[model samples]
Target: MSALVEVSELRTWFDARQGGKRCVVKAVDGVSFAIHRGETLGLVGESGCGKSTAGRTLMRFHNPNGGRILFDGNDITSGDIKPYRSRMQMVFQDPYSSLDPRLAIRDIVAEPLNIQQPKLPAAERDAVVVENMRLVGMNSEALSRFPHEFSGGQRQRISIARALTTNADFLILDEPVSALDVSIQAQIINMLMDIQERSGITYLFIAHDLSVVRHISQRVLVMYLGRGMESAGTDELYAHPLHPYTQALLSAVPTPDPKISRKKQRIVLEGDVPSPINPPSGCVFRTRCRYAESRCADSVPEMRDAGGGHFVACHRYE
Candidate 1:
């Protein structure tokens, strides 16, 4: 199938005021990727690597400084996002902070429908909310309670219910299970998989955890300093990571078997991640990479087709 969402060289920058110096922080600088219909595209990176920012930009939460965002064959990089809000939804990382304490569970879940389709009857909207709640494994009685009354997992379920109420085909799941318990995380992940099976929703799953990304993603995109490092099939990327940053990342995912874990060669990268403001020349990840050379510093590497449909952005890979 063709891409449902196509983003080309998307850039979202922010001005930072540090002491007396003013500088532009490239939160999402020249990033590009696509999300096909009915597929989960995992975007993995370290904290403050602009993974979340990319997701928000795609959802039009932030006005991109440059490039285009095409959704469903139309350019939606500018103008009012209200028309597409219902078709695209975002479930935030923190369930506690995302939901409003003032509103009851039922009201919170039905908010999208109420905003987008205000003319709908009260009973009909309530039914739609309840059905969405059911899809996320939520109890009907809990709808009367506030967000604070439920557990972290339950609150997240309510959040998911709210996103689903609009029948959004594209969902940006930004670390949706990061805040929940391990067992609860599995439950939510399974629920998401079930939702995909039933509704064929396209997902841009962003997370720092490689293991979680591996579980639900068919394709994975690795990011560093707001730029895409590599993107390939989940198994392909994990088995043969082309970028050094990706190799270092995959090395950290813990293995279940004692023997395999013991024998595993962890690629411990050195140095702190460079700031987005005044990032290293040529390549952002070059400072910490072991394979950095004069060529790596001289010019930025473009994404190259590295056999078997895998794409990598590294001089060494090129």
Candidate 2:
């Protein structure tokens, strides 16, 4: 399969004033990865580790401070983003805030069509909204209702409908199921998978939950402090996580099987996440990594293929 989206050395930085000192907050620093067509690439990390920033940068919502963004082999970062708008779409985390309260559901879902595919007539637009709503398991009853009238899960379905209005095959799902209740999360996740199966859509699913990522993703990429710690196929990464951070994350995910649950060793990390504005030198995770040595603090680790295409950015991997 070919890459539907390719990001290389992507960086998104912000200027912040901390006690009168101007500093750069490296929200996403030098991140690189590729998303193949029809596969869900899960991006997992702790809070403020640039997962959301990377998603936004890929969607071209936040202009990258540095790096290349190629969408279907075209350089989208440097050129006009208008053409990319129709082919790619984003589903946000909060359904309540993402939708318009003032507009009816039909109007809300059709908003993207108005912006991205205005050539479609009103009848076609209505047809597209209806089909997408149905695809997301939303009935025609929701077409006339307001956002506040629906549950969290239903609102998220509406959000999904809006994203699909532009007929996008590539979606940036940024914490799409996080805000919902655990019971509701499964429905949304399952629906996303079903949609992918039917439409062959490619997704960059960003979430903090390792379990959720493992369920929906074909490959997983772990990030820390805006840097990619490791990336591999889903089962491979979980079974044998190379990076300390990846190991700690996987160890925390609760296993359902009794035997595995009993044998799993929880890796409890110490210390607070470093400030993005003034990150530690060398490996960003050295402060919390139990396997850290003097060499870990001397230089940054370049991502290298450990084996079988598993890439890890840790000195220990050598």
Residue-level lDDT tens digits of model 2 in 1-318: 899999999999989899999989999999999999999999999888999999988878889999999999999977689888889999999999999899999999999899976788889889999999999999988899999999999999999999998889899999999999999999999999999999999999999868988889999999999999999999999898999999898888999998998999989977767999989899999999998899989999999999887999999877
- The TM-scores of all predictions, comma-separated, are 0.98, 0.98
- Model 2 scores worst on lDDT over the 10 consecutive residues at 265-274
Judge candidate 2 at residue 202 and give its lDDT.
96
Off by over 4 Å in 2: none
Clashing pairs in 1: none
lDDT of 1 by residue, 1-318 (tens): 999999999999999887789989999988889889999999999988999999999889899999999999889999988889999999998999999999999899999899999999999999999899999998889889999999999999999999999999999999999998889999999999999999999999999968888989999999999899999999999889889999899889998888988988999977667899989999889899988999888899998899887999999876
Please give the lDDT score for candidate 2.
Answer: 0.92
